[model samples]
Target: MLEIHQFPCLSDNYGYLLHDPDSGETACIDTPDAAAYLHAAQEREWQITQIWNTHWHPDHAGGNEAIKAATGCTVLAPEIDAERIPAVDRIVKHGETVWLGEWDAAVIGVGGHTNGHVAYHLPDAEMAFVGDALFALGCGRMFEGTAPQFWTSLTRLKALPPATMLYCAHEYTASNARFALHADPDNAELQTYAEEIRHRRDAGQPTVPSKLLRELKTNPFLRADNPELQARWGHPGDAVATFAALRAAKDTF
Candidate 1:
């Protein structure tokens, strides 16, 4: 089993440190803040052996050099955005497997947020580190790809095991929940989930690592194909069009 640590960084971003106890191998997933990652590692007496970056966004890969300098860790990044990521010791392609100690994680290409964005899925761990592709009740903006591309990316994510735990890069759940309510106002599950999220935030707790099952029910972005949502939005039965409409609405929401 892997021991994972989640910590806040760079105002709203979250840094994940995944440790494999059997081999004492620790990997930092994305680098929102290099100092924060270093501090967390030092505090736990763990040496960071690897860095798995999901994209080339500054906030996600900003600390690559610093972290590698500090720990001499091998930096692995998506092959598609290799130019943007610094200090990338290795390039990982989609459908390829990367090893973390004795465990392996499959790299899934999830573009749209960034044309080359990728997510790491460890089946044994039942966890996925989705950079900016998917989020709680929301999804990454179409900054580098089209709505259809983002929709396809999200579809792949939704196909993960229902029990999979999604570790998103940011804490945008509260705001996403508000927008989700706007799109799916009559969804009782969303209403309940929003209330719970409100309480958690009010108490200064993290609402991340949301369950795939829960997101499937409450996240509007993921429910674009739902008959009720399509009808409410006056969208034809096309999933791509439905997703495009909702994504456009979210851009301004």
Candidate 2:
């Protein structure tokens, strides 16, 4: 089985550690700090064989060189932004797959947060490492990809298996939940989940890897077609447009 671990690095940023227990090999996803990555590798006694970069943002790719230097690990990232990332051992394009020990993951291009942002999907495992594309209840602030691209990216994610575990790169769920409740106050699912999240956070725990089905039901970003949100926000022409308005409201929220 593939064991997934979360290493919260550099404030809210998260660097994921995926280990194939049988192989004793680990893959680091978006190492924000080299020292922390090295510490994890040493502590786990797992060989750091590969590093996956989801985007070119420093918070996401800053430690590429440092981690590679320390562990001799391969840095694999989107082909389009390969030049921007130092020590990119492999430039993976859409449809390309990478092997983390014996397991495999498909590379999916998600260019809303950044021009070359990519997400990794392990379909059989029903898991995805989404870098700023889709958050727990919100989505990434548009930086490089346009509203259309961002919407498209999220739609793709929503189409995944409902039980798929979404591992986002930031810890923004609590704040996102606040906005979600405001947008859909009577959503019983949202209210219950929010309370649970509040308790988890109060107890000093991280809120992440939320199930996609839960997001589909409660996250406004995923509820573009919900008549209530559209009625409250003034309906837009399309699903993407409606989602954009909700996102804009969330920016101020």
Candidate 3:
């Protein structure tokens, strides 16, 4: 079976280490802090064999070279952003597959946060290491992609199995929940989910690894296509426009 070790790093960033016990192969989901990742792997007695980068942001790929030098692990990055990332042993594009031990992770192009961002989906595990493309009750800022492009990217994620567990890269749920309530105030589901998030944060617990179904019902960004949201946001029948408006509002919220 595959195991995941999630730890906090770089303030709010959540670092992930994907380990396959049978093969003793471990992959760092992203290199936010090399030391933290290395230490986590060492504590688990797992050998680092691969580094899978979802995007080229400094916070996401900043520790690639150090980690690779220390462990001799091959680095896999998005084809479109390989030049921006360090020590990339391979550049993978959308629809490509990468492996760890006997498990295969499909590369999904989810480029709204960044033009080249990708998500790793392990079907058998029913989980995805989504980097910053998505967050609980929210998503990444539209940094490099357009509203239409971002909407399309989100659509792909929405089509995933409803039970798929999303391992997003940040501990931004509490803040995201605040903005979600502001954006979709009448959404009872969101109201309840926000309350739950509040309790989770107060308890010093992680609010990541959010299930897709709950997000679909509560996340305003993911519900841009919903008739109520589209009408309320004044972009009836236009999911992209609704998404753009919601994103713009969140930026300043």
Candidate 4:
């Protein structure tokens, strides 16, 4: 079985360790703090075979070099961002699968959070390591990509099985839900979801590994075609436009 554990790094950043106990192989995702994860892995006595990256964000890839130097593991990243990420040994593209023993993940180029951002989806595990792309109840801020591009990418991701568990890079569920509520306060579903999220957060638990089905039901960003959101945006509005306004509100919120 593939056991996935999360390490909370640099306040809200989450670095993941995917371990296949049968194969005894481990893959580390987005090393924001190399020393921290390196130490933890060493203590666990697991072999760190590969380091995977979703984008070139410093917080996401900053610890790549340090961990590589210490562990001598192969680094896998997007081919487009090779210039920014010098440690990339295996430059992968969309449609390629990075095998982890019995489990293999298909890399989908999900740009919009960044120019070269690509999220990895493990179909067998039903997991998505979305770096700064889709959050719990909201999407990542449009930094390097346009709203249309983001919407398209998100649409592709949404096409996946609803049971697919999203493993995003940050722990912004509570805050994201707050913005979600502002976009459609009249949405009782959103209100209830936010309340549950707050309760989980208050108990010091992660409001994550959220299923795509749950997100589709309560998330305003995912619910672009929702009647309530359309009513709030005053009709005939694109979801991207609605999202842009929601993001703006969040910026000041």
Best by lDDT: 3
lDDT over C-alpha atoms for residue 122 of model 1:
96
Where does candidate 3 have its weakest 10-residue lDDT segment? 126-135
The segments of candidate 1 whose C-alpha lies over 4 angstroms from its true place after superposition are none
Q: How accurate is candidate 4 locally (lDDT)?
A: 0.83
- Tell me the TM-score of model 4: 0.94
**Candidate 4 weakest ten by summed lDDT:** 234-243
- Compared with the true structure, all predictions reach lDDT values of 0.94, 0.86, 0.95, 0.83
* Residue ranges of candidate 3 with Cα displaced over 4 Å: none
What TM-score would every model get versus the actual structure? 0.98, 0.95, 0.99, 0.94
**Which is better, 2 or 4, measured by TM-score?**
2
Error of 2 at 95 (Å): 2.3
Report the C-alpha displacement of residue 122, candidate 1, in angstroms: 0.6
**In model 1, which residue pairs have backbone atoms overlapping below 3 Å?**
none
- Model 1 lDDT on a 0 to 1 scale: 0.94
Model 2 Cα lDDT, one tens digit per residue, 119-211: 899987889999888889888888777878887778878888998999999999999999999888889999999999999999989889899
- Rate residue 118 of model 1 by lDDT: 97
Indicate the residue-level lDDT of 171 in model 3: 96
* Candidate 1 per-residue C-alpha lDDT over 1-253 given as tens digits, one digit per residue, 9 for 90 to 100: 8999999999899999999989999999999899999999999988899999999999999999999998999999999888999999999988999999999999999999899999999999899999889999999998999888888899999999999999999999999999999999999999999999999999999999999999999999999889989988888687888888999998998
The residue-level lDDT of candidate 2 at 177 comes to 91
